[model samples]
Target: MENIAGTKSSLSWAVHISVAALVLIWLFPTVGLFVSSFRTADQIATSGWWKAAFPSEQNLTLRTDPPSTQVQKGGQWVIEGNLFGDKRGATISVYGTSSREISTYKAGETGKFRNGATITVQPNGDYVASSDTKWKGGRGPRVFVTAVTPPEFTLRNYQMVLFDPANREGMARAFFNTLTVTIPATVIPILVAAFAAYALAWMDFPGRALLVAAVVGLLVVPLQLALIPLLSLHNDIGIGKGYLGVWLAHTGFGLPLAIYLLRNYMVGLPRDIIENARVDGATEFQIFTKIILPLSFPALASFAIFQFLWTWNDLLVALVFLIDSTGETTVMTKQIVELLGTRGGNWEILATSAFVSIAVPLMVFFAMQKYLVRGLLAGSVK
Candidate 1:
């Protein structure tokens, strides 16, 4: 007994360690995406998400110029223009003539030039200079700055990706489109397969083994092999490229697996209880409705979660059966793919999209996980 217990403990430890390693590996990119999603496009392009945790040194541009047509006052060049305009409280830590290398100067220090000109900059975009000199023909001198940015995060990216309609169609509508496809696609197969599974498992039937065999056979068939044929069929059946077509496609593809899974779970149900329902003069439908369904809740919930998540995150079927070139029929996955192509450098948008896509699946799993733990699987195994 002690030996068995020790072996069990070792096996459990190995499983736990393996799970931990898998979890970390899985989460690393997700965490990186999440961090990157909050970052600016430039910031994401230049540095990894880890660097965002600390202040980063970057070369940025700063400029000072006279207002358009500034009038001389008291024989002085009363030039005026906004330096670092609309930056929303950016402090000037440094400035330079060329963009290549920028350096900071003390607020009270003077920048002496080769032309006997002096430049002094204040913290508040104010500047003073004394020079017996004139700026070069029709252009002002260029400046560069190396500034330390504090940890600045913004919801603007999320708003832009999810809510801004005039700017673009955005992921919000595609998120809803995904639901439109996913909910029905997930539900139809399960609904149809539940009755089929119940019939095969508990009801007297003709060719039951053959039906099960067919479903199992489909498990090995690659979906890609059928995509073109399915699309041609859709074009023929008058459904064309739309919600109805994709829903039907998903339902067909999902049904075999659904029926197979539900049949295994339904077969494991207690025969005595089903027989007792028969003794109670219940029809097959009634037994299925009242006894089998209530008893098969765990398997149903588990399959629902699985199907819902798959259909929610699916892209290939959407590409083939649904009209995705235009933004109208795009799903979250499709929209995300487009965003990756056009705005790959935008980390925050990517993260926000990722989170939005999975939010519903996460909710369904959390809410239904209880069924897996404490429901019909208990009765089935025993």
Candidate 2:
């Protein structure tokens, strides 16, 4: 008994450790991207997002105000300004007159120039340069600074991604375009598939088994097989390539699985409730709309999520059926690929774009995860 209890405790600990490890593995990249999205391009390039929460020590080359900006202050010529320009939180640990001696003077200490001038820089980046004689340089003198910059984050990446008109890779239009594609594609299939599934499952019909079997077979058919044929058909029918073509194509491809899942779920509903509804003079359509539809919420939500994510992230379908040379209707997935080609080295932009693209799907999944889980489990049992 004692040995068995010890073994059980060991297994329980092992399971917990394994689960914890899996959670960390899944969250690591997600957390990294979320953090990177808030950072500026320079900061993202200089350091990892994991290190974003702490101050960073950096060597910076900067300059003071030029001779043209020098002013007469108490009979001395002086150039005074803030080096960091509204970025007031940085602390200059040390600085120097030359690059070779970057950390020669501590923050706030004045360093004498070769021309009998002295410059003092505070921790907050405020600087004052004064000379007993008139200043002579055409440009400002170079100042090398070693500063402890506070952790920085910005919404500029998001702004550029979402709102900047000059940004060709902006997700604003693509996000809406994706929504335009997804909403109809997701909804139309549910309504059509639910009616068909109800007919195949509950309502008696000739060749019902054969039709269900056909839908099941379609589940195994590769979408690639239908792409060329479907596109040709769409073109021939004058629909061409646009939101309508894409929506119809998504609905067609998604219906088989939707029908299969819903048929199985609907068939498993208690026959007594459906029979009694019919006995109370409920028509087939009425029974479906008023009774089966309400009880089949889990299945509907599950397939809605599946189709929404599928159509939202579909690059091939969008490329083949929807997008054209006009480029007005590019979706998020296509926009991300465009970013890969145009801003490949720009990790901040890429990270933020990628994060924005996925954020909606993640929210949808989390919101409907309970229904999705129940639908899967219930569908499998029946």
Candidate 3:
């Protein structure tokens, strides 16, 4: 008995450890993308996301107030101001008047220049330079400062991707266009599949078995094979490359699986409830609307999540059927692909755009995961 109990405990620990490993593997890239989106372009390029919390030393060429802004105080020429302009706040480790001697003076120490001027810079970027002789020049003296800047983050990437109208490559229109494609594609299929599934599961009809077999057969067919033919058909039918065409394509491609899943799920629902509704003088439409629809929430939600994700993430279907040279109807996934071509070197922009594209699908999955699990479990019951 003790041996069996020990084995069971070991298996439980193994299962937990395996789950932890899988979760980490899945979350690692997403967490990296989320962290990268907040970082400046330089920060993302220089180090990994895990190192973002640590202070980083950077050599920066900064300028003091121009000689034109110098004031005469205490019978001496002076140039006084903060070196790190509105950096929020950063720590200066060392600084120097010449690039060759960038780290010559420690923070809070004074250094004498070749021109008989003394400059003092504090850790917080406040600096003072003074000379008995008047300073001359249109430009400020360049100071090389080695500073340990605090971990920096910015929302400018997301702002540009989402809201900056001036940015021609922004995803605002693409995002809405994706929504336009996804909502109707997701909803239309479920409604059509649910009604078909009800007829297959409950209503008496001929060739029902053959029809279900046909749906099962269609599931094995590759959607890729149909894309070209479907495009030709759409072009001929006056539905060339638009939301309506994409919606119809997604609905047709999705229906086989939808009908298969909903039929199997609805077939498992207790027939007694359906029979009771019939005895209560409920019409078939009323029974489906009031009884079966309420009972089929899990299946509906499951299929909705599936179809939503598929349509949202699909690039091939959208490319083949929807997007045009005008580029007005481009979706988020296409927008990301375009970013890869245009802003390939801009990691901050790429990461931010990718995350924005996936954010909605992730939210929908998390929100309906319970129903998804329920539907899968219920569908599994013979």
For all candidates, what are the clash counts? Answer: 2, 0, 0
Q: How close is candidate 3 to the true structure, as a TM-score?
A: 0.84
lDDT scores of the candidates, listed in order:
0.73, 0.89, 0.89
Candidate 2 TM-score versus the reference: 0.86
What alpha-carbon RMSD in Å does predicted model 1 have with respect to the real structure?
Answer: 4.9
Model 1 lDDT, full chain set: 0.73
Write candidate 3's Cα lDDT for 1-382 as tens digits: 5476456664788888999999999999889999999998878876778888897777788988889989999899999999987774778989998878999999999987877798999999999999999888887788888887789889999998899999888888888999999999999999999999999999998999999989888977898999889999999999999989999999999998789889988998998999998999999999999988889887898888888889999999999999988998999999999999999989899999898998998898888888767656644424
Q: Which ten residues in a row have the lowest lDDT in candidate 2?
A: 373-382
Candidate 1 residues 1-382, lDDT tens each?
A: 5476456664777888999999999989777867776778766766677888776756566655643434455655444444555563445566655444456465435665455555676554455654443444444444555555555667777788788987573688888889899889988898899999998887767898998888788866889998999888988988888999999999998887778778888999989998988898998889888888888877787677777878888999998999645658988888888878987756667777877787777787688777545433532322
C-alpha RMSD of each candidate structure in angstroms:
4.9, 3.6, 3.7
Q: Which stretches of candidate 2 lie over 4 Å from their true place?
A: 1-8, 66-68, 72-77, 94-124, 130-144, 279-281, 378-382
Which residue pairs overlap in candidate 1's backbone?
Answer: 37-347, 37-348
Higher TM-score: candidate 1 or 2?
2
Candidate that scores best on TM-score:
2
- Per-residue error for 154 in candidate 2, Å, reads 2.1
